[model samples]
Target: MTEAEKFTEYTIPRKDTVYCVEFCGTETSSQLLAVGSNSKVSIYLCKFREEEEVEEFEYEQLHDLQNGCRVTALSWSPETSITCLPRNIRLAAGGSDHRIQIFHSDLRGNDSVMVLEGHTDFVNSLTFDPETGDRLASVGDDKWCRIWDKDGNQELTFPLSAQGMSVCWHREEPVKVMVAQKNGVIKIFSLSGQMQLMSFDTNQVPLMEADWCVGNKGLLIGAVAGSDWVMFDVSVSSRPVERRQIHVEGTRYFRWAKCHDSLVASVGRPGRQIKVFNAKSSQTPITLSQTVTYGLSWHQKLPALATGGDQKVHIYMFDSL
Candidate 1:
């Protein structure tokens, strides 16, 4: 690895296998992130201090809530766009108990929790509408995609062709959402009419993940299936316009940079190694060959990445990945 590929990692003090991690994408919540390990999920406020001598990253534990079960997925509400001490924020977490927990915190220790129960099996993924933040979408082993309002009421439930793996909303068109299945089928749903807008297949079995390109305003689709990552231009074709092998062992997930059209990241098995690539040039300049990793995410604005393995949540800043 070159010097630039060597990541400057800042570790959180928590010690446990981090199963899921998500950086808050809401406006003022840029300094916030959630780390789920064991049976608890903790939110932290990060601060960077620069001095003439050195620079450091400081962390403040805001809310540590009991999950009642292992957390499978996490999503931050878009309404958490304020920076204040007495701040009220919402976070939606899917748990192994097959329930959706909406944690309403006010920067205080207490939590007003609302549990949305419908999934008859493990909840694999959960996401909040980035535009309105008033709706939550989830996919699960039950082979169903459930949509709920922030108030915990079920608004819609659609049957998936197979076990749901991942789901995310289009950043540009909030009413449109994408759902990926373990059977390799990817579908875009229009919530306005509760209808299918588009559908395609990876051709490779067991699709692992799918994410909308927020940096590209959701015009592009990115997914990894059977160790191969593919990109689709929704306006152009039903099949991937670009495809490349990212991991030989198997890809666990693929995430697009929140603010860059060219940057992408993924974690795969055998060693749980993480790699960052440029989608435009088909180049992977930086790769982290870690032993074990469960979660990976990017900063809302910067090229920074936060990943969990061992016991800590480590953050990597590109600064000038």
Candidate 2:
């Protein structure tokens, strides 16, 4: 296993805890990052300066949105360019105010913004479609999953039996989405049919986070409440093909490396340990840090990782095995 070397660290200029962080572009065109903190979302522009054969992150603070509530979820639209339109960097965020807010970089510092209201409680997650970046999916504690168009119109809403925790779009199939619920069930829904296509039951504990394998088809990874990690192969069966006790306590965050097919990262309670596991093997993980990590995000284009906790964000560079 290859150890990840610490690249750089930036301390957020606030005393509040950071709930989430996300990159604003793909690996090929990433330009900004959005950080979700208490009652606001701050934007940072990723700048690079080459020094002694190393590229450093010189992120500049662009702006901050006062959401009037705790911002819990954030997602950026896919990078695209059309003939007649200017380049747009769209951001979607959900918060405790029970509304979803959409912002565009082109219209920053202006009154041109859209807010969609549907969830009755705190929204937990938000994800955009990979193909056209028009459709967005959001889930919340109110047991509702909603889909919205680029124009901020509600296209569809589904009522779930359990509270929703996270939602993710398939990398290859745009119409398919996976939603993790509090009752330990991950359901895959078809946007075209507005119906659930498949469901996987962890049956261990509540599922807080789930992500699809970007490099593999029909493979899913989830973080359970009992400090366990489970991998499911939908093409084979609904049951998990592999399960392992990841943490001594509970885990709430899980992210798959976009460029590495075998590497998966997870974080949990009790300490500041982040573990990177090989999806195909049951060997010991390559531990990253000993600091309490509340948030984890991987750069889409580079082998870099950003973790937020302890009032600071640490960046790391690693070589994928």
Candidate 3:
């Protein structure tokens, strides 16, 4: 009858607090999971196996890597291929040291990781371009959004009006990208000409994070600013179409479900209480309280939500209705 009772839950125990969670899917069948924590990033291969008539999700540790510093944000590169037997995977992780590390691993004993030197402040977020995983987009407290190629070369840099909070690639637009600044301004850019396409302001100042909707062709964008989360319809208005408060002190993270257009997840500070809400609804359907939590991520295909907790990674699958 209860929201949490109608779902299945999975947990991964770690030695330290998890700061971020990212799921990567492969054509070979299994899914790869990346969880970032203190000075290390743990990678796992996850899959759903049918036990009796019920489907059960399972994961196996594939890598326990030393990141050289506390990882704050992470993104999976599009170059990952699991169609062959060896299974090659690439992941980019940003650390507290204000650097980005690219981890290239495979089953064939050719595992190499490289550090990307950029951003004078702590890296806040990073995402690989959806069209070609070769390019990586990132934002940080350094007031810049920088792009890097697969070879670890910094190719482009875009100065921000404030501390850059989040950056993401448009899933549908091959050359479109977005950057959310802490001053509550959101800018959309065209990668082809490296020209600013559009810019909009949130309902309030101090935006913490923002995400692009998957179901919309980069039309709808969501962000967490101040104590409220707002959604912007770029094609319709220069302002947010929806804005509501879920956090009292402040909201930290905001993520739209990759598989669903109207579903979203957010983390509020003060207590780190996470909420799952429908875009059109005022009431949140599910809430999880983790006094000390860091990030929120949605499963690549399934209707599952994952979050980082104190020394653990928690995954939940609930009926969005």
Give the TM-score of each candidate.
0.94, 0.88, 0.94
Candidate 2 at residue 124, lDDT?
88
Q: Per-residue lDDT tens digits of candidate 1, residues 234-256?
A: 88889888988888888988899
Best by TM-score: 1
Whole-structure CA lDDT of model 2: 0.74
Tell me the number of clashing residue pairs for each predicted model: 1, 4, 0
Q: What's the distance in Å from true for residue 107, model 1?
A: 1.4
What would the per-residue lDDT of candidate 3 be over residues 1-321, giving only the tens digit for each residue? 786675677888888888888887433332778999888888887775432233677778877778978998999887787767677778899999999998888846678898899789989999998767889999999999898887888888888999999998876887878999999999998777888889989857789999989778778999999999999999998877888887888999899987778889889866888888889776655777776777888876777778888978888877544
Over 1-321, each residue of candidate 2 has an lDDT whose tens digit, in order, gives: 225342334454446677778875464356467888777777776654432232655767767877767778898878432212444556788877889888765524543458988889989889888877889999999998899987888898877779998888877778888888988888888889999888988887767788887777746555565678888888889888888888778887888877677677888767767877778886778776645566677777655666776566566656544
lDDT of each: 0.83, 0.74, 0.83
TM-score order, best first, reads: 1, 3, 2
Lowest lDDT sum, 10 consecutive residues, model 2, at 1-10
